[model samples]
Target: MAEWLIEEGIGESRAILVEDGAIVEAAIELPGALRPGAVLAARLAAILIPGRRGIARFEDGSEALVEPLRGTLAEGAAIRAEIVREPIPEPGRPKPAKCIVTEAPLRPAPTLRERIGKSSIHPPVGPDRFEEAGWSELLEEAASGEIAFPGGALRMSLTPAMTLFDVDGALPPAELAIAGARACARAIRRFSIGGSIGIDLPTVPSKAARQAAAEAIDALLPQPFERTAVNGFGFLQIVRRRERASIPELVQWDQAGAAARALLRRAERAPGAGPRTISAAPPVISVLGRNPEWLEELGRRIGAQVRLRPDPALAIAAGDVQSAHS
Candidate 1:
């Protein structure tokens, strides 16, 4: 049995390296603010980055390969000490991933609905500093085919003239753009998204193509939508009204990693506890870029307990949620 650490609401997890299938011998080292998961990640999973990797001691005492944890893993509650399998070695070193092992107990934070539940909203007007730091495991889940949430299902299409979203619910469509060349006068309302969002739509060849898609999106826009732009890389440009302390885009995260010195002590500790439970969630890990299933497997290996929640839906800000009510 091992310890598994999972992030709240997001689709990522992490594991710790255990000696002889035991975690007490694991040790972790991290750099930065001491979040709930800092110490364990450093010691147990030896999570250097996020991806599907494994570290197990062989019967002959040889170190095994790494496969990071990935995907949206949720359960009614944490399961401790259930026998699980170890993965085979990768043909080669694939790109690494992160395992963001974080979870703020529900007692302190806002309810999942309060955090993201929105019924409808207007589109955003302009761009704001939209940055968030997430573990590579999160990205992997988004990029991979085994993703529990579909990309199209999670993202919205925003035009400066209109905000476009399709919820399989009662609300109608919405729009904000007006034929181009104008900034929105006020902030567009936050649509009812579950949480972090990603988008994919038709490709636009020229400015005309941009507006054409906008027009089509606009025609369906009966309620109120926001604005969006596309980047040179063909990535959709989403114009979401910024949130307070959002997930931190363009962010960087990694497991604090283990000091070679720490290895000497790992042998003396308990199973899954990572040689030491410096903190409740000792092992701290993070993921960046794109990956899928990097977090789930990590949780299974180390046996960290996690309480999964639905992804954050689009939360209407105080003003918008209020205005939306009005």
Candidate 2:
């Protein structure tokens, strides 16, 4: 049966839609992020585009990019704003959360459980259901931006503008283009990627081949998305409603944090645990140490003492959990 297997992990909540014993889609929600639909009371911090757009400073000192502002309102004027999109992390200048002026009641961001309401919620526990559903492979793809299909591979690159996928393999141009397009579409859905996307397929001279490649994307990708036809240059663009960071964005933004959270999840499921020792790189250990509450909760859940050990030689993603007896 198809179901969303949710795992409320230490620092993040995750869900995977499993169908026929395979993951079709996945999502991760980090705590404290300003999810869409959250309303905040704030002051106009700065006027970016005179009367049309400005910055809103919340009471907590954080700021969001607010738009459709009243031209009469100057800086320092209090206003209620509703978040339309979460902050997007980029190379140097990250995009701030986006909001619109509103009179809606101020409400905290919805929790993952609340956001995914009434869905077939299967709280996976005791066993690592996510790992069983190729979770590690998904994370690897998100981190490395390399996905392998049968006859070709997709190299995804994240840019300030859009996510680009370059398809390459040892196949005929027409055949590879069709297969790569399908693979790219599946990966987009699997990673919950949104926003602007560009796919570069093999250059096929035949217009019919280009149309077939575009059709492959349409066959797999769901609605609420717009895509341009495959052009003569074998380039296609897709636009999806982006509200929050995708899995690749989250992993690439802070690899150490991603590793830390993943380690915590693994430690929670370690076998025959008494005093569990988590060994990893210093940065990853630092992330875990900063969150003592997460460690305490891990201990409480596993009925053991959680310990952190930093190894300079260890890679961030090479964290290992060992039982006291081991």
RMSD vs true structure, all candidates: 22.4, 1.5
TM-score of each: 0.22, 0.96
Poorly placed runs, candidate 1 (over 4 Å): 1-109, 116-138, 141-208, 215-225, 228-238, 245-326
Q: How does candidate 1 score on lDDT?
A: 0.25
Off by over 4 Å in 2: 120-124
Error of 2 at 314 (Å): 0.9
- lDDT (Cα, 0-100) at 225 in candidate 2: 99
- Model 1 C-alpha lDDT per residue in residues 1-326, reported as the tens digit of each score: 32222112123111222223322111111221221221122212233343443342222233322333332323221211111211211223322222232343322223222333331121112221011122233323222212222122222232223233322212111111221111111111111211223334333356655555445534533334454554332233334332111111111112112111121112111233421221211222122112224334323433543222222232111000001111
* lDDT accuracy of residue 43 in candidate 1: 17
Go through the candidates in order and give each one's C-alpha lDDT.
0.25, 0.89
Q: In terms of TM-score, which candidate is strongest?
A: 2
lDDT of 2 by residue, 240-309 (tens): 9999898999998888899999988888777774799999999999999898999999998888999899
Error of 2 at 246 (Å): 0.9
